[model samples]
Target: MPVLPQVLALLFVVTWGVGAALLTSVSQLSPSGYDFIIIGGGTAGSVLANRLSENPQTKVLVIEAGIRLVSHLKSIPVPDMTCNSSEDIQDVKIPFLATSLPSTSVDWNFTTTDQTGLNNRSIKLARGFVLGGSSSINFMTWNRCSNDYWDSLATASNDSIWTWPAVEYYYLRTSTLVPPSDGHNTTGQIIPEVHGQDGPVQVSLPGHATELDQRVVDSAFILGGRFTYNEDFNAGKSIGLGYVQNAIGNGTRSSAATGYLLPIVDRCNVDVIISTRVTKISGSLSASEIDTVEIAQSANGTPTKIKAKKEVLLSAGVMGTPQLLSLSGIGPKGVLSDLGIDVIVDAPAVGANLVDHPLVANYFTVNSNNTWDPILRNSTLFADVLEDWEIKRQGLFVDTPGNTQGYFKLPTYPGGVDPSTGPLSANTEVIFANGFAPFGPMSFPDSGSYMSVLAAVVSPTSRGTVIINSTDPFAAPVIDLGILSTEFDIVAMIQVIKDIQTIVATSPWEGYVTGIYGDLANATTDDELTEFIRNNAVTVNHAVGTAKIGEVVDSHLNVIGVSGLRVIDASILHTIPECHPQAIVYTVAERMAALIKHQYGI
Candidate 1:
């Protein structure tokens, strides 16, 4: 009925009423033209928007498929300033509480194709569809990949830039390291030299870790006696028992949208259009460059074409990038033909090489009163916990829930041979959460409090694909998350479970543990464990390698057959890292920004 354009601090906000129709006119464009048109204003895209738009003359526009949640650094939602109710927006700012939020709003909620390895069961693939992307919804752990993982990428693409020495610079550039509160270096857990002081994103430890955390770390040392105590994994190596760092600051989630985009929203050259999905790139099939992008605010709304003068950067993440490329006819010939779409690049590797860590959750009941479940289970204590966080930015709410994490190599079994490759570089990641079923709603049994330890296979050999299911641009992609598909991976998982059981059964941990649950609880032998694994396998939610470097794109992240079009997100990773992929994604985006700046001499 009316058009309202409210411009404040260079931000142009456009609001629409319920059931508003798309403008009949063509999509509007700036006269000077944007130097970069970034799709999906998520983690990487948000960083690009901030870095590329630093020069006032350089114009950048970010088209996001989800809502814009941050406007200013102060306005960004924090755990303490947010809500006590899980139904409220503040729930997202709380690290552990975020996982319990419904997927209807911010998550794409895509499921995998029936995983043949796991008894033909389709697993839920919860990808963030909101601004800041998965960083906004993921567990706040900020562990980086192992040096070997980077070396593997360098070898895969035949590029030395992917090596640790080169890539670590980008990691430093993306983060503003927060040292452990107590100033001393060796005495405290965190290492200061490994961190950068001046950067955009903030990296900090949990505000309030529980006593159970220390016990877990001590237990891990007892279980894996061979590995050294690595206080900081982000420094380079990730093979030891230590406190897992998180993307948090002052008891709040420091998401990409909050850290990178919000503080610089006042830049005159940067434009962010949220709640808009880019359907396809309307460019020549034979041509090497992009012409324009087709996008719609609503699913059924009319698609509008907007020109991209310089380049179109696809930072839409692992799932979105591959799906968008295929929708634009830049994928396998057979897949394009099946969907009746014109073949643009015939890049068979576009959606192939999909890899993700397979996780098996282990639950334990605590014999002591040290568990966090009782406080969470009691209404009055829980209310006090919420109030303490909201008022003082302290208490259990400030923690990431999982206080201690251990990364270790699988021990060589007695009378058993190891993989031909020899000792692996940290294959298993064990996270010890304080309370029972922290992955789900804060629930507990009437009998006793519980703790959860998730043993996840970090370096999986199984590969799968993310292919288009239909010609409809908005349709969900078919994701075959081939987790634990190989016998090698299954064997590794079995060993990791055995290690967890051993750790739980040891001195301090053994004294605290009263019972066990899930796959291992009922199983005694390896045969029973294998069946339990097949039945309980789940993703760690670290999906990558769909459109990888050297295959779908070059070493520099340029799409193989297209110019003025680049894929610079998790999709460009040669393989899923042995740790969380968020830090790697941030580093990639930082490097991409530097490369683009150098290319344009900006």
Candidate 2:
């Protein structure tokens, strides 16, 4: 045989071998059905699906509103490309789209009635509509709420099972911690023994850290406080200053759907339906039990009925979960009656107890000497960042600009146990992002506030409610955040503003920091700073407690007045966590799934 022909034959054989392996892995996934149907393949839904399907005998169906689309960008750990591109931001903005609804596709696109605390201005609320739920589109910063917040739930609900120690086990079960590597932080350190090393979801420090992150750490300590490096904030103690660990793994985004759902797609007992929007849940409501569920499909715009052999789980998140309950006639009696929805359960607490982390960004323009300045203003440089993300999966993109985070107990009432003694009545969550903008520095000025520090009031006393506007399931619900409506909430926010201003003023970067408002460069009064914050603050979109657990659902997350139907998402959080709600959602979903499996013996 000729040498050229022999070489070509060898090349063909190698290509064929690679192709065969790919086909074999892809073919392992087969369509299947389940006895229990879980709606929304998001944070909780994915965990529910994974845990429920563990039993070979039990069939599980996860109905996701969006498809499972994976790409290099989705998996990378870099932050440069994470929020820079339009596609990345759009995906992060709304992971799922409602095909049936025009203009508003994947995103619920919710808005709160004017927040009186925030200068009486309305803010946009974006919730995920995709398989992984909001876990796919969220900021990805992982921080479990403080012990006090979790302990309070136990006290309020009078359930020992809701205690911090009980929930801490689940947090450990679902997390995989990535310790800080050398040269990443000069002073910061993460304790690996306290964090989980071998878990499905990836939690690691960003590969790259800008100089600004170090300055923030030094500034936080300069503010005259103990700043300890936190390796695993998920351990349930989210205090002190440390590098923000995120849900990204191996330089790629590792959402719940990716970590939990994709790995089990081949299971014969689990069925995942994409592009399915569940409009209304119809069930037989006799006294306190629900026996059936009729879900509407967005693809064909029709409804299908399915009988629940055990229970129907609602992992539809804060927005969808409440909306589903209201549509099924399980909310306030008068509200449902007005909407012409037959009152099945008449649970008054269905859409009450709404809570969210309101964010206020304090911006400062750094000297051109700042590392991010060149890339922040140049599109070509931005393109290079994306290419680096695509090829090496290493660069600035993996770093979530807010590299360092801290939780502080702020003094609220005069002589309020002197925060030095114990946990204060209110705590402020400070997140420092390295980039100059909110979404992206170059995208839109109104969008990005330069060198932003998002200070959220972790434990606000204010509560709000969500109500249906009309009988139409597609109609957007009316949301009243009632933010800062309570005196305590206002006081907490004011303290946060003061804390942030003090950090910026006394920090090592005082010379490097220039106020967002050019004229207020020398402003020092607390009132002036508070006014600036009120005008600039926005919601972090970590909304929860709408269909609060315990109040609306039992310990197992089942609606109090309805059996077979349960809410296993952020909506069921008894109260907002002191940290981001994503990590809590993952833990709750995992625990909920175990509860369901044990209940059904499947």
Candidate 3:
């Protein structure tokens, strides 16, 4: 059993387990009118709930589709496994273990419509429907994008509030850095003093490192690259190779629920409802201003209406927020008409600016003497690591496999401009993952990819739109990710693939391992590389910018043309950032909560 459950079980045993259940039941039943109604109690909603309810007089209600937070096998911190394990990925569809709850039960199992690029296959999108949202299921990489990415948004939106310095304060306030222990070498660093020491989230380096990781780092340096050690990647600059700080602490995933929600669950002013889905957000027009939101609850296989006194906040993430907006007659005119819902706010931009990073994976077979082979072959090592995590909160299970990630501009993207300057080359990001595996356990190769790395092009200018197909709340949306429609995206990926090839060819592995898939190592032509990428690219699963900020909503995160409604999740990102988005979502939620408090004087 995990440490948390053991602690809870010990406490439960002391109180006979009856008091624990009774307290939980009592907290669920005790409810009153809230000043704010937050939909989707995940990453952003949890922060909003905790911060807004800080005022003793203010009431906050957070509605989630999953149950209360619990520590199980899936949620336990295991450093050896990536967040995208067979168990985690397969859990989205199965319903056997407490960890393997059905995706339809707690996750909005959404899929994109067929893409014209990449053989026209619809991709499965798994957005968490649980209380902690995607943060609960995401790889706990605590990386923030470059400052220029946010400054560009501020310039594009004509709003200075989105500037880097303005948002940096929030990022600093939310994170607490774990001080480096004895014998840890953290040199040539720019550590910031403003980082919180008593914050809810715990950010730290991995406790263990495999020798394969060291070889990959050395190889990068040998290939004419510079490596810098960073104590906090959230300090507004992420452009080097280093151990990635994660959102895990003391052998448990520090989800927003664990960091923010669990501490405030017993508060009188906070109400969290699980297994409740918000079907629609209805409003009336009074002298050109919207008034009152009519909320429908999914009860007993039917929809029931409820009213909110103040405002409705949608943190249902990139996919679900737009779906809810379209269902409530607040999207494109054509889309709303097709769904048979009358258009109230003809926000043509709603669900229009969809952006995501597409990753091209490269694999290498390592020598038997390589460090990674032992972990792959030894089941006893794996079990021992798990046991160590359970007992001592130390082992391979607590560390991210993607220990050293590089955020650098490709030589072709000098001065932040793609060599092929077109629609698809805007604000690109090249994420280099070391010692990682793209496929899961069943597909684990014998001599697996030694230092596998994926180069993800983030903040792509390629924009797609997600549309509603039916009036049914449970029906999946038509997500058309118009990937690689522009020539610039193809050029960028070709350059990235070439770059990875150069690293692999020049690395120490040249003597030990064969090339990528045998006989394909020395292909130098751009056409060959482009074709190889087209046949092998997969999504990094970092989808964002669906219901984009400033286009579909106002600066305060409110949906334009509709009062008493706002979206406070990844859907509000005006553009995709150059890194993983979990930390930003958490910051956005914290800021949103403050905005709400200031607006209502709560």
Candidate 4:
């Protein structure tokens, strides 16, 4: 059989609940207090659980808000997948369905507040409610971001460990680069020596070759200078066109659950509780540091106060971390006072400094049928690819359709300030995928094949907030994505769109590219472009800065006013890392784990 598939990037089938456990009742919990309690057993929590529990004497407990999707052997076939919403494991495992997982049971489907920058249009904010958090359902990009961003993080925290060399060491040490499945030569695709050969998480290049992959590489070569090809985007220099690397290997997703939790969760000292909500944090409210958490199976269910003998780590992610803090009376006085909850601390920064990447996609009708339109339009081809993946763990089902990631350091706009830490950090990012853009409510054209150019302002200046609307733990937080709120963010996003448009229109794509589609075509003048942008601006789910370091949490990631409580997630980022955040999030978790162990001398 041949190796490469005609279709673009694919997906892979995985054995759910391989080593991870399911929801356990509060009665099943240990009576004796645990040494540590990690809230939200998602991405960061999973890692902390694994690392913290390594000491045999230190018992660790992970309270997760969502269910761990599990299935026994001889389960229903992938083709026989009857459940679309409730028991949809494919929504999490299949990379082709990456965006489709949102609005499902596994997702905390949040809608942001109306933004004036986007002409008062509110957008969807999807957060993972299941195990491994966003890592379980994201596009699986292992973007390490820029060295400059890490140095700035160290400067912001006044800690030398976050410096480029220090952070870069962990960046390479904690995860390994897996070889592509197709046996393709990776000589120019990646720098093998720069990556960690033996690590927990496995990252890999495109498993199969496609027609669009070469065109993207050729277009980068054709359009010299800024659009030059980058052999390794993960080597601290993230700017330029490069092969997209995902946290996947052996035709399976490499998430926190797969890489961190599954390996050490069954230890005698580790206790994982799923389908449990962390309601309120007690004891830590006062100067006395006897930190304990209240957990429940449901809103009406009985609550149990689980004592943390040593410390409590909050890994509730960007929205959940600050929202949880605010709910527990550890927030701004006005907010806590308004709710009649006793103010534990006057931390206005708990839900402040919210940042997100403003994303916009440009669609085009390509002249070639070599694209993956058939996979979207034809049922026969889809079935064949699905069968190929299920039977042999190969073909179009091994990855998402987007195969190329291009970053650019655009020139500063007129009267606009650059929020990026350094020149190495990308101001703009463009992703190339076959088939029509899967953004907005647009439908596929009845005739020609399509391609999407997703451009995101990686270094956005706009800031938003995350505040609890009600005291009820079930109530969704008021999230203002703050996308396109600043002129600089808008300017940067526009430049990315223009730059990608220029790339496609280059001499290499002269005949293969048909023409631009929809609003982008009509947007000619700067004012028209601005109007077009305001009407269509959205975020790419790369949120950070809420409950940021230096404000809400100290340099050590401990809560500013609270004791025995620390936030070790994306919420504690100094600023957005100017890229897809999973790599940075995992790296930070690893470092914080070591810090916690050292702090306790465990």
Count clashes in each candidate, considering only residues at least 3 apart in sequence or on different chains. Answer: 0, 30, 9, 7
Q: Each candidate: RMSD to true structure?
A: 6.8, 8.1, 5.7, 4.2
**Candidate 2: regions farther than 4 A off:** 1-33, 70-106, 179-188, 226-232, 284-288, 414-426, 439-450, 514-530
Models 1 onward score TM values of 0.89, 0.84, 0.84, 0.93
Q: Which residue pairs in model 3 clash with each other?
A: 42-132, 78-397, 78-398, 79-396, 79-397, 79-398, 79-399, 80-396, 80-397
Which candidate ranks first by lDDT, i.e. highest?
Answer: 4
**Per-residue lDDT for 495 in model 2?**
77
Which prediction has more favorable lDDT, 2 or 4?
4
Query: Which 10 consecutive residues of model 1 have the lowest summed lDDT?
Result: 1-10
For 245-348, candidate 4 gives per-residue lDDT tens digits of 88888766778877887777568788888889888887845643638898888889887898898888999889888888988888888988888877878899
Instruction: Compose the digit string of candidate 1's lDDT tens values, residues 311-392.
Output: 8899988888989999898999998999898887899998898999888877887766766666654555555665676567
Error (Å) of candidate 1 at residue 103 is 1.7
Evaluated against the true structure, the overall lDDT of model 3 is 0.62
Over the stretch 86-145, how does candidate 3's per-residue lDDT look in tens digits? Answer: 332222110111122323334466667777766665565656666677666556777656
Off by over 4 Å in 1: 1-32, 70-90, 179-186, 220-224, 284-286, 413-424, 438-447
- The lDDT of each candidate is 0.74, 0.64, 0.62, 0.78
Q: In angstroms, give how far residue 395 of model 1 lies from its true place.
A: 0.7
If both were scored by TM-score, which would come out higher, candidate 3 or candidate 4? 4
